[model samples]
Target: MAYPTLRDWLFSVKTFAAAMLALYIGLAFELPRPYWAMATVYIVSNPFVGATRSKALYRALGTALGAAAAVLLVPPFVESPYLFSVIVALWTGTLLYLAVSDRTARSYVFMLAAYTMPIIALPSVMNPAGVFDLAISRTEEITLGIVCASIVGSSLFPSRLAPTIIERTDAWFRDAAFYATETLSGRIAGSAISGARQRLASTINGLELLLSQLAYDHTRPDVLARAHELRGRMQLLLPIMSSLADPLIALYNSGRQSWPEGLEALLADVIKWFNEPLPAVSEGYHPDASADALRERIAAMRPPAAALASWDGALLSNALWRMKQVVDVWQDCRSLRIIITREEGSWRPHFRHWRLGGTQRFYDRGIMLFATVSAGLAVVLACSLWISSGWNDGASAVTLAAVACCFFAALDEPAPMVFRFFLATGISVLVAGVYLFAVLPHVHDFPMLVILFAAPFILVGTLIPRPQFNMATVLVAVNTATFISIQDAYDANFLTFMNANLAGLAGLLYAYLWTRVTRPFGAELAASRLLRSSWADVALTASTLPIEDPRNLAARMLDRLMQLIPRLAATDDHRHPSIESFRDLRIGFNALDLRRLTGKLGGEAPAAIAHVLDGVRTYYESCVNRRKREPVPESLMRSIDAAVARVISQGLANAAAPTATSPTSARQLRDALHALIGLRLSLFPATLTSPTPPEPETAA
Candidate 1:
């Protein structure tokens, strides 16, 4: 590895100190195993100080919870090892499902909880009386390690997440701005949009981790609201950029699209601002107000009604309209930059203003349910084989298999990961044996023990941030420390150690077999279920639920959109889910607008409009319950036309009043009409194609 920075060296030093402290504490207290505490120091240490504390707390809780379960479970089934094994397996499986569902540090608690009982109980099957004492010892050692790691990380010039968040956001904005320039410059390649989508999505994901750490930081809440604002604004940009690109692409294909006058100038301004050297956080930044001027110019210069429908006029209209939108989005970015710099202290309303709702990872219940059953069954199988063979080390196999299954719970293909872990475990055993018998005899003091172990731990801290072999490094370090089993009085027996290690290998071998057999299904069921879920949201949108805010609702559905993109991209099959997923995105957005538009109705909307919504709701519900593609009734189609006319007249009548609320009415009507148009396209795309209607919905 390349030489680490000063921060990396500091982290390594802190982790090493914590591990030695944990060992000393355990030895001084005469705990059964000081090594467990020592090893946990490495396991819980995180570069971010707050993350270290968070993980430490969760690990402690998980250990205690697991120990409590072992205490309750081990004694009753001692006589019948088979029944006990099955019960334990089921417990691990159930908890494993919950563990993988949350893709955060919190998952550590559930994973530890799932395995803690078996770790204590399995070793004492023949001597069940010792189970409670073993569980207590295990829990205490683990908790001691957690406490040591947390204290060391928090005290030793701890790394702050706030500065990292700022640096990361700046880099992300630069990439996005470059992409926007390429898109507007008409140099966009066929793959560019998808690549941009993935990059932006990944950035959003990374930001969320930093956002979660904000509570642990001393940063003012008003400055943090910019992140929330940026997320919402960024989400809007992708769809708008995509929508704008489509018409431009069509015009380019026909050799009609050209950059509108001053469009490149407006785009250049945004690019330059984003690419500028970032100022210190205290510096004020006034956003370039060029967007409003460009928008007004475009509005004033729009073509007359007749020429707009012609091919040449259509090309210019699409280019100018989308350019204005791009400018608007860039302006929003500059506004967010100003807030992030904390330039305006008077905006106290922005403090604590960011609320993250509906940001959970989308785990299909089917996957979780499938994993829970497989984990339990794999354990039961391992146990039955051991019990029938009358193996003294059979409990080892049962516990190892159960723990391994839960450990790889989040992986789609567990067999490969299990094999990697198996390799790491064997390497750990060799290292542990070397230290147990070869080095420890001469190391008579705690300080000498720390010196002997310091190099190995420093290596772990060095390798922790690596992407490729980090997991293996972790397992080797953890397994070696755990297998050494340091106590006040050291006992190193070759036969007993070899037997335990071999049993663990056997358990992992069978686990790999089980994982290969019960591999996660990648075909239709998950895709179908997710598509149906989006339809259910549409049905909800049609219900009496208030639609005052669609951001939360949209955010939740957008998560499923991300899920669908990857699944569809993985397959080469015909009738891909991507088409349906794209349709669902449009449907979800439209449903929100439809709901909002309907909410503002004062019994003035045409009665036929109500009937049209009812029919659409029925169709959506049908899609959810069964994958039926029931087309909208021709009568409902006609009513949509009538509703469009009603909305247009109302918008026009309100146009004369021209208050702040007038623009809102205009926007609502436009959104409602856009939803109706999208509904028409989705329901009967091939058969009922219509020319693009004018803005006031004057087309039949």
Candidate 2:
């Protein structure tokens, strides 16, 4: 085990202090369950100030909402225990579905609300008239604990998430740069690239939680905007970088001797540019002279009109075009990072032409719904047993089952995690049992209680900051606090303690078994669903007539790719799916770009482009229907080549007679040519032969 750092020790000290403060206050206020106040401290405490505060707010709101729900519902259904259990189960499930769907820190509110109803209401079912008071008291105690945690966490040696975000952003950019450089220089290994891409996607996806916490970080609006802008550019960069691999690999496979003169020089220069460091944020952000220079070199190296009609020329042109995009996006990322990290600045965005997608994510509703329902059923099962057996402490069992269910509803396989919870809670019961029977009864006063609690609580709090130990330590700490049942005065009963703790164990065991039985498929189902969703999206994009922004399509595909990565890793089906997702992302971009470019191309070009798109739609639709990858038809290849030939020929014709073509018309023709070339490359990387160009005289 790694030794704890000073920061971990500090966090532990602060957390222990907060817990004690909450306990002392609860005792002074004469709360019914003073230990509950102490337990709440651990539940909401985080190493970072902003995260702690955010959780505190969510926990407070969820607690109030849940308390209100219990106050209103428990009285009406108290006389009908079976019907009440059913009602509670539905409430938990419905809220859990929303919580799981959100996929954000905000989901905590719904999750807490889901389980909190059972925690408060089920215990008061026998005393219907007292439910309201019970709810109020529980809310007050929990809110007090939250307030104590927030104050202690934020006010003492507060750790801000903003700096961590900036640090992570730097690391992400460096890794992406390394991947891009390796790919461009033709030295990247397949496995290396795969792992790099997965890490980049995971980092980008993981930032959502930290970014969500930024609002509570006292971050400036401009800084927040810069952070988000940097994220969007990073998303934009992934597919472009991945797309560059195909054309470059194709060119490399054709042999170094076939490379155009100065092509390697140009590639070296671009790689050098990526390796160069930018000016620091304190120096104030300036334009990246290197990115501009690299783009100019790339533009100068664009194939001549005659060469554009050849297979090698198109491949070279597409690769250079994508390289230029990577440079532009990288420069934008640098500017945003500098701005975000700057201590103070008045900054203007350097890149605003692209309309990036919003925060809408791809949630597997079917799987999430199934998981939520399973969680609800676990609650129902626990309740039925409790009601049937007339167990006096059965309320704790039902409450814990609901808590266990809500804790990991968002995971692909929550069975293992639930099992961990069982073990942690079991350990906690033993520890709490010892303290209740052997230790606490010997303590007569608050300071003495604090002295006794210090060693264990502080030790466990230190482990909370380390991710591997976080969940287990949290369960142990919180459950131990709850189990000890510290009231306004000393009251320790051996039988009462065992009954409640055993019931909790029973609830957790049921949850574990229920999850294992219901979710045996694990990540495979979710991974397949994400893949199918992307296929469906591609099919829809290809068939739709109205122009869609390629950026939005890129955003959705990239986001889907991010979500799919971890699941793919878990299933050990990584390589093939990663390739397909990247290919689909590139295809979606090319398809959308083609649709937009269609409005600019005239004559046979639009007809040819429509043919290619129709084929794309058909191919993807077949994949979706078969629930497997369908082989691309030779007809699609023919159509893509036809579209490329038409666009290139028209573009050449326009260039040959400058007087006949407006600047706008020439630019449009060029864009269409590039899009068609990209589509051809994406669909047929192996096909090297280009169609015959039209005769110059016939073009004129």
Candidate 3:
């Protein structure tokens, strides 16, 4: 048997209570006929409909404004059904446009107006005199519903947004620490590091979103300011985190004897400082005496200890340099403790890729709008058909509106959700109608109805917090309850509701299938392109250098390599076949990092290689700072070309086994070698150049 989570229990109790309250209001007041429609106002008032409070408020306001507009216009235009339809269509279109264009406060206002047209206007066509009364009644019911839902939602197992923000912040910090440790250990190579960086960026973006949601809750400004300060500190930590790969790889390859003395102790201190509460004094004191002792032990071993006896002096120096950077990061963290504590102000909008702009955004918006309008139309058609017939005691207009709200609100993902909405709406309508017509006629007690409604709500609510099938099941109960409660009595409309729902399900299924067919191969192609691009960059960076440059070109190259790390991580799918290829690309980048460090220290004769490495590092550093994949420097490219030519020339002349070989064979060998070098060069052009056609081997 599956266990119920905290969310499940909360949702069950709240939903049941809301349903009971709606019933009481309808029964006690002896409201006019179409009690089902009034009850729908309560159902549509769910907070989840809008996700955020502001959006929900906007949606409510839109509903009210649109309802009022419908009442005012219906008296004059209700006689002409065609005119009313046109007015509703125009209003809906305008509202949708506002929703799309104005993402802030005004967006929801427009959307509410757009959606109100069919619900309020279409129902008043038969009895124009009743339009004003119906609109007023709906406004009252909806307002009451919103108040009740909000009160219950807030009091009953409310998940406070602030705590979520703090948790995400802590998670991001943990991931960052893990990434740093892995980079230093040499366990994560080039592409993997890139992937890690990408993950870090995404986590940061999520944190930003959380902070934004929290900020909207009318919290104190001081708390919000503190969150902002903490976020700034984290942002400052990004570059330092990216730069640790070089020292880490150097330490990993230095052999045991070449390892920095007390390096492990320093690492432990860094982790402790990050994980533990801040020390009282930021600068020269340690809260834990043992941590101080460890630092002292490491400092004593620093210049030369047992660990360094067999190691080269240069490697030791590089290790110390990297360790000092880590120490500096810890010191910054300690100083920013206050900022981290003030968890309120960190909220900001999420970072969306500017590259995802232009046509793609427009298309997504269009799909959402189409889904919403179609859903509204479906609801209106169902209600109109039911009313036109003499079956007056069946489902009401309000019931249809409630269904529309739930279905259309989920237009965020139109394809998959369309069918789910249809199924939910159809089933709810049938169950409610059947209970009223066949079951309710025999049972006169309110207690039975409460129990009957409670059973389904409890079952669905309890199942809703699970990971996979929660949504589908919860919708079933919610839609059913809404349908049952609103209508005064159920008359037979089972087949009509079922067929309409089936049509909705079909629309959603078609959209889902169509999207898959149109977007096939995007993931694999994206991964391949990213992999090839990163590889070409690594190769080009490795081949170039500026002679006599003092800046450690290896460090620069490592920085360049870090830029690709995130891209590689983003392209990963645990099940993809090309994952192995991605792994190879990562290893190749790490190898380049290693080669760069060795070249810098070995001080070999090809001074041009050193200069090119420096240029590569510079370009990489620039790219990181700007958060973009910039062109490789021209100076670096020319130097790489010259070095490749020189290497090829030397290899040809120094062919050791000068056997009696055919001239054609020699020519072919020379051409192949040159082509290989040229291909590498073409991979990392310093400008906007078309990608070279892949050779058969690379393509394979």
Choose the strongest candidate by TM-score.
2
What are the per-residue Cα lDDT tens digits for candidate 1 across 289-370? Answer: 4556666766765544344434334445545555566667656665675566553533222112112244444567877778
For model 2 the TM-score comes to: 0.95
Q: Per-residue lDDT of 394-437 in model 3, one digit per residue for the tens?
A: 23432333334433442333345445655665676667667756
Better lDDT candidate (1, 3)? 1
Query: Could you tally the backbone clashes for each prediction?
Result: 0, 0, 23
Q: Candidate 3 regions off by >4 Å?
A: 30-56, 65-118, 121-135, 154-159, 168-174, 189-218, 228-240, 250-265, 271-414, 464-470, 485-700
CA lDDT, every prediction?
0.68, 0.82, 0.48
Cα lDDT over the full model 1:
0.68
lDDT by residue (tens digit), candidate 2, 1-700: 9899999999999999999999999999899888888999999998888789899999999998889999989988988998899999999999899888776689889988999999999999878898889999999999989999999988899989898888788788788878888888765356666677778888898888888888888887778777777787887777778778778877887788989888899888877877777676557456678777787888888887678777677778878877877787788877777767775555454344343554556777888889889988888888899999999888988898899889998888899999999999999999999999999889989899999999999999999998899999999999999888888777888887888899989989988888899888878888889999999888877886553555655566778888886565422232367766777877877787777778767878898889889999999999999999877898887677777777778877877988987989877777677777667666765553333332323332
Q: After superposition, how far is residue 504 of candidate 3 from its true place, in Å?
A: 5.7
Give model 1 RMSD, 1 decimal: 5.2
